[model samples]
Target chain A: MHIEFEFSGGYGGLFAAKPLGYRVETDELPDEVRDKLLALIRDSGVLELKPAQATGGPGPQRDVFTYSLTIGEGAAAKSFAFDDASAPPAVRPLLSRLRELAVEQRMRP
Target chain B: MTFHKCNCHYIPPHVLGNMAKKGDPAVRQAARTSAQQAKLSREKRGVQAPKVPEMLTGIAMATAPAPVTAAREVYDCQNKWELRVKLARGEGDPEFGDDDVDTVYGYAETVRGYFAELGRNSIDNAGMNLRLNVHVGENYMNAFWDGDEMAFGDGDGQIFTSFAQSLDVMAHEMAHGVTQFTANLDYYSQSGALNEHFSDVFGTAITQYKLNQTVDDADWLIGNEIMGPTLYGEALRSMKAPGTAYDNPLLGKDPQPAHMKDYYNGPNDNRGVHINSGIMNRAFYLAATDQIGTQKAAKIWYHALQNLWPTADFDDAVEIIVESARTLVGDGVVPEGTTQTVRLAFKEVGLPS
Candidate 1:
């Protein structure tokens, strides 16, 4: 899924920079988002993020990102979380650099 | 190359522009390079990387249930809203009043009353039957709606409690379902805020109705029951007072803005939709509380919610209420102080001021 963003607010100015939001499908992620998602994979405490690409694609896209968030997949954790947990990290920071990248993309005129 | 997100993180687009157009080249370069490198990396990585299982991807991804690759491994919790029910040694014990029945029935009863009160007796309350799972993610410190069902975690038994303890909380999660079915409001930004607003509106209404209290008697707090018993946090947010919703260090102070003037901006969490909902909540609070004399006065707030609210954004909501007020109260009489109060409150927030 390659999701295209048709912003509601529309870049207000010739130089308006806004985060282009989209609905996720899981398998397809834009190039920038995929990079940071992947970056988190090798960071720490993360072993691997299973076939979530096809899952995280938010609209239409060519590829997916690599997310390395494996907080509670243990026996105890598995019994609790929903059958489909989120791939993206909620307490983001380690991905601050990636976020900045996303910010930059939004800022692009 | 964008991440499909609603982004309610409070970092507005103009701010990003400031960082880019005015900030140091290092910041701009860093941002640009990150975007560039990410694109290059995606091309390099392709689809080879395995995606994370769907079972553990919420805020508490660290402690989500493992993916069930099997065709059928449903942990029914047997309609029992109790965690201990699942731990019955060898399953020979009698069926416990896990509260699951009560939870399910409670939802049914609430909806029944809701429709009756609004003459929506035929709206089919069964459209959303809450499938709550208690004691999720073992000692997990978080609970969230996963676009489908509602799941609760035994909050590390510290920072929070079982997310199921709060009726308003349950109503909040269930409200997400209503949004998904109705407007399918995007989960971040204005749409996200609208989404949260719906939940808060519905959740608060359901709680109030369940308690048989009108708007004046109800505490306009969202997730008051979901707060950590050990900490000093009020409900997740206070419609009466936005910024002061929470003042803890762990989750940080609540960033919710009571008025549109303070509306947050960001790319994450759909531009802080959840935080921005405070504005709407406050609007409802102000509209209802501004009233002077009323012993058993009916609530236009709930009337708007059950009979009028649209799954859509503020504008759609306003239109619906204005119309519903007409239908509920009069044709040319106009709604009472409560109805006007909502509009005035919205105006006060700088939305249309």
Candidate 2:
């Protein structure tokens, strides 16, 4: 299964979005790394995340970034948004990896 | 080869190592724990933790004399969030025709005046110059101490006003600098909350000291003036009533907890540094208003801050504050009942006295 991600807010305003059925073969990543990453995503429970608040607090979130992620597509598609100020602990590693992927995608020719 | 550096910070390793050998078991354990954590923190920060001589029996390391004058610098980000923007004003510079610049410069001087009156050399106790950046980000609504200098935002015009408008916000950020120079409290978990707590404490202290307001007369609301007319809450955080700072349509209700049982356990907000600090903040408010006056309470808290380690937690805070108060009372620096008042205050906050 492939993952789609979008991010905004904060200083950088890094943003991205992907439609459903975006698939990446396991061969794209090393076997060990891919397995570990897949396990992290599976255990993250991202599929059940409800939509988070549009803004964090009454005060402006200077360094807080908002992230929206989708796993799978069509009837199985799940999307959730979280900000840097209040992102759940279990999903942090996944988000970090996705951020790296986003950066790599940006640098490609 | 990776160099293993001495982990102890602020306090020389030789001093703590000597305590580890000669002091009681508890002292030894604390020294060891501090050393270990310091090493880990150094590793994380990737900075060289200087190693001092194991046995400095009677050596006094040569150091430069501290500057006597306070230096202040303010910068304008020009609505950009990037740091190190153009220097708008410097020490003794003429006004830049900018309210935020003048406010930050004047406030820094005010904070410096308080510290000088208290016999503190500067933020680092070495006369480190105060650096401030204002108008950070387009409509950004927050101000923070980035471990070295202070940064402020203009705030979204609709929801919040310029952060520089509030004296307490400036004092609060500068107080973080003071804590950095003294305790260098780690910025995560309970220690992080303590760091925020000490900032808030001195934040209110500077405001009261400047305005010559008594504990009762003071509003005890942080960022009180920076709130826009349309915002829901009166202030960003309230020391008088921790959970009642603000609640409105644009901004959600304040989530700060006033007691230990209500402490947030989530992994967000750096383990709820801003949220749980309300407990200790209230403890100080209670101690200052009902028990001892703000002067004695501030002295006791400052002493306690100096006694705290980087990894100190809530219990450590209670213990140190009470001990500091008792010591001050014994020395006649504070009146009697100070320690009892401190204990009662902590007890009221659901912390062991």
Candidate 3:
């Protein structure tokens, strides 16, 4: 599922809509692929990553999602989660539009 | 092969053969760990972009460094969101100079060029690649390196400005590249904090060096501009004192631990690696301690960071600094005995035994 972007930007950002969580086939995946996924932790577009939270208690929870990223400096072992806030008007409109378009495209099939 | 190359030069103590009889498990563990990290760094280094002599889009042979940091191109949303077209530097056609919110991509485009230019000048043998990705998130307060590329964010502005406003932050992020290409320290616990501290130490240190300022002259704050204008504190992390950077009501106090005995531990990826990094962050300050800009100070740190800190954790880092000082000045009281002084300074914070 796709996650909705909401709140202020960056790590402490929140999600307006619920995140579309996916369970990757971890054990079967190759190291390079795992590395690539870990790299995405630093990516900004991502929001509401639950598994990404490695430390500190959760802040005002609004459907927190977990995503794994390299933690504490560079170790891939630090799993951390994030708080999901409402998306701002500057970017949320775009995501809602995209979501609508996606549904339309799927329904066309 | 006996010397495992992780950070600088890690001599793996062979328990089975050579000078020392079966070394204790501690030594063995150190050797094995260094060997493992060495293998990882080697593997990661191997993944370099394959040689491409021909330019894909006329980037061509590198030109002379720009006279100043230029904001060449800006892409409003109407333009294509393609990185290649944007990177193919050129004068504006239709969309280049508007700061319109609808097309704010121009600022990011300029940052991209800054990195591209930096990448060419910083040679591979020198061991670095300039990396940057802007427009990171909605209103991200902080930006950092994840052992690879640089990330930027539009700050909360309540406590900071955009991340780009601070050159030291850029230096700090780039130093991560230096750290990755060099020591490749395990980014957790003390080593992790060292990783953070080095980034800050080297980060702010380079900024001061580049700006031609001395230690007393340097502000010694990390991500100063990233915080909002209203905030009383100056930076995200302070090399002199970690958690003391900010104590705003919003983000709460910075929680970086200051000493080894006070080190934070949790299952969270080698214990709050980032939080605990304050200890080693303090160590580097103590190591570099009094002398800020002199070549002598940088030299001692360079020796330790380059030759000594290969796989050193907190205590190990202090040991290496002492060793590095001895190697640099050799015997009898060297000014501050940079290495010895570093050890002493760290002892002040309870790092070195």
lDDT winner among the candidates?
Answer: 2
Lowest lDDT 10-residue stretch of candidate 2 chain B: B1-10
Per-residue error for B130 in candidate 3, Å, reads: 2.1
Assess the local accuracy of residue B29 in candidate 3 as a C-alpha lDDT between 0 and 100.
39
B1-353 in candidate 2: lDDT tens per residue? 11122222256655666775777866875665445444544543345656565224423233313433457879998875465588999888999999999988899888887877776777766566788889876666667665457778787675568888777888887887677656667766798788888878988998898889898899988776776766635777789898897765433467788989888887555566777788999999999997587877989999888778778999998999999999999999989988888999999989972
Model 3: per-residue Cα lDDT over B193-242, one tens digit each: 56666666655665665567766676666666555666645556676776
Residue A7 CA displacement from its true place in model 1, Å: 25
Local distance difference test values of all predictions, in order: 0.45, 0.70, 0.46
* Stretches of candidate 2 exceeding 4 Å from the true structure: A1-109, B1-69
DockQ for every model comes to 0.03, 0.05, 0.05
| Candidate 1 Cα misplacement greater than 4 A, ranges | A1-109, B1-95, B99-108, B111-129, B214-216, B292-312, B331-338
> What are the candidates' interface root-mean-square deviations?
14.0, 12.3, 13.1
User: What would the per-residue lDDT of candidate 1 be over residues B108-133, giving only the tens digit for each residue?
Assistant: 34643553454332121222223445
Ten-residue segment with the worst summed lDDT in candidate 1 chain B? B67-76
Q: What lDDT is obtained when candidate 3 is compared to the true structure?
A: 0.46
Which candidate number maximizes DockQ? 3
Off by over 4 Å in 3: A1-109, B1-85, B88-129, B146-148, B230-234, B268-270, B289-295, B308-311, B330-336
